[model samples]
Target: MALIITDECINCDVCEPECPNGAISQGDEIYVIEPDLCTECVGHFETSQCVEVCPVDCIITDPDNTETEEQLRAKYERITSDNG
Candidate 1:
């Protein structure tokens, strides 16, 4: 699944740089994760980099945008291909 930043986010500006997909962005109130761009770091890392760096643990899996590992990999490929 993709990740979502909760209201609990402290806006410390940590998670944004950690996201390889550039999915995290500053919102009106908190950091927001774009589900379509989030691959949970499947192809880039063993775990989610945002979750690793977030001090408040405000990032959580987005149940509403759930996807399997294979699907996540596909997304990663698509994104990287666009960049290439």
Candidate 2:
């Protein structure tokens, strides 16, 4: 599943740089994770870097954008290939 930054985000600016997929960005109010670009760091790390660094713990799995581990891996591959 992709991750979503909830309204609880404090916008401390820590999560943005930690996202390997560049999925986290400063939204009008809080940091937002783009579902298309979010793989939950499947190929890049054992855990989601943004979530690890977020102080407020506002980031959570996006139930609305759920995907299996295999799907996330595929997405990671696709994203890396596109950027490579």
Candidate 3:
């Protein structure tokens, strides 16, 4: 599943640079995650980096876009593929 930032987000800017997938971005106020690019750090870390760095625990799994480990890996590969 991808991650989503809730309204509890403090906009501390802590989770921005931690995302390996480049999914997190500044929105109107709080941060937002691009579900298409997010792979929950599947190919890069043991867990979600945004969650690790989030101060308000706003980043959580996006239930609406549930995905398996294999699917996450595929998404990661597609995003990082050099050959495209």
Candidate 4:
């Protein structure tokens, strides 16, 4: 599943640079995760870097954008290929 930054986010600016897929960005109020680009770091790391670095634990899996591990892997490949 893609990750979501909830309203609880502190806007600490730590999560943005940790996203391997460049999915996290500054929103009007807090950070936002682009579902299409979020792979949970499947292709790049053992864990989601943003989640690892988030001091406030504001990032969470999006139930509204649920996806399987395989789907996330595929999405990661697609994103990398397009960018490559």
Clash tally, candidates in order:
0, 0, 0, 0
- Per-residue lDDT tens digits for candidate 4, residues 33-67, read 99999999998999999999999898999999999
Give all candidates' CA lDDT scores.
0.96, 0.95, 0.91, 0.94
Best by lDDT: 1
Instruction: State the lDDT at 31 in candidate 3.
Output: 94
Q: What are the models' TM-scores?
A: 0.98, 0.98, 0.94, 0.98
Which parts of model 4 are misplaced by more than 4 Å? none
Global Cα lDDT for candidate 2:
0.95
Local distance difference test, candidate 1: 0.96
What's model 3's TM-score? 0.94
Q: Select the stronger candidate by TM-score from 1 and 4.
A: 1
lDDT of 3 by residue, 1-84 (tens): 988999999999999899887899999988999999999999999999999988778899999989999999999999999436
Between candidates 1 and 3, name the one with more favorable TM-score.
1
TM-score, structure 4 vs. true: 0.98
Q: Write the per-residue lDDT of candidate 2 for residues 59-80, one digit (tens) a residue.
A: 9999999899999999999999
Tens-digit lDDT string for candidate 1 (16-70): 9999999999999999999999999999999999999999999999989989999
**Ranking of models by lDDT:** 1, 2, 4, 3
